[model samples]
Target: MNKHETYAWFRVVFIGTACAWLCWRLFFADATGGADIWDRNRETMSIVSYAFVFAMAVFTRPGKGVVADERDRAISAFAAKSALVALSLVVLVSATIIGTEGHADLLTARSNGWFEHYLFACVMFGWWVESAICVFHHWRDRR
Candidate 1:
């Protein structure tokens, strides 16, 4: 596999693992100091996650002999556009649900506490989608 494909897989796996861990901490695990603790430090958690992702992107260089060709750039642009579309759809749906008070089951947050966290999670999911798309195209290219 090429560096791009490797990096894309890394991102998808990392984000999936991080999200799963967060979900476990939120619902199943009896985290120290309670789950409400994360509510108080949501911003910090978000910042840390964003920083980690950015750091990974920065550090994941193309290596000494690797070079980005037109196809790579095209794939990246397409993936980015697809991810943005996914994000916009998510935001729109979320806003509609929130605005209309349409679905009680959908809003499981305690006192609407999880809305901000939900948006952050959606953004991360969007990133994951982008990486997944990149990986898919790369694999398709191989086949």
Candidate 2:
């Protein structure tokens, strides 16, 4: 494959890995009883994510070859569209779930669970949704 495809592959792998980590943390944050590993886990994931994005920003589409050829643009466009829809669904569901309890002492109620859980869930869910969209884009483009 060419540099563009290589870049895309790396990008997907990086984000996919990060998303996997986020999902793991979300589910197991309590299993570890919120130990130092939890903090380290989040920090490492954040650093890796930022580093990957920075590398992509510096290295991606580094040519006059349409900045992003037709396929790349198409894949990204489709991915973004799907991500938007998926994010909207997440927000709507979160709002619905949150509203169900009517915010009665929201920040204090034990019933509310941790706010970070929802935040992490939404972020990871959005990334996964984008990854799925990108996969669909690749499959469709290939066919």
Candidate 3:
């Protein structure tokens, strides 16, 4: 596979694994009395995520040959449009749920940084969605 296809697959895998682990740790692990590694090492994990993004960018950097062609750009554009739609749905659903909780609770959640965390999740979800779309399109093109 070409670099773009390889990167798309890698992005999907990495983001999917990370998001799944995070969701489990955040929502289920505590109830099951499982490990609290995520809570204890959140800052470290954030740094690691940043490093991973940097590494991916470096991996996709332009070489002597052409970096991205028209097809790659088209795939990315389509993926991005779909990702935006996914992100909008996530936000709308989250907002609707939060809105049902009333203004006082909303203020409290905001003060507790719940809103910030929600925004972070939204952004990550957007990237994951985009990567997944890219992977599907790339595979379809190959077929």
Question: Against the true structure, what is each candidate's TM-score?
Answer: 0.76, 0.65, 0.80
Clashing pairs in 1: none
Q: How close is candidate 2 to the true structure, as a TM-score?
A: 0.65
Model 2 worst lDDT run, 10 consecutive residues: 106-115
Which portions of model 2 miss their true places by more than 4 Å? 2-4, 32-42, 64-66, 102-121
**lDDT of each model, Cα atoms only?**
0.75, 0.63, 0.74
Each candidate: RMSD: 3.7, 4.3, 3.8
Task: Compose the digit string of candidate 3's lDDT tens values, residues 10-94.
Answer: 8888888877776664445543222244344556767877898898879988975779889999999999999999999998987
Order the numbered candidates by lDDT, best leading: 1, 3, 2
RMSD of 1: 3.7
Candidate 2: lDDT of 141? 65
Question: Candidate 1 overall Cα lDDT vs. reference?
Answer: 0.75
For candidate 3, which ten residues in a row score worst on lDDT?
30-39
lDDT of 1 by residue, 69-96 (tens): 7888899899999999999998898778
Which has the higher TM-score value, candidate number 1 or candidate number 2? 1
Clash count, candidate 1: 0
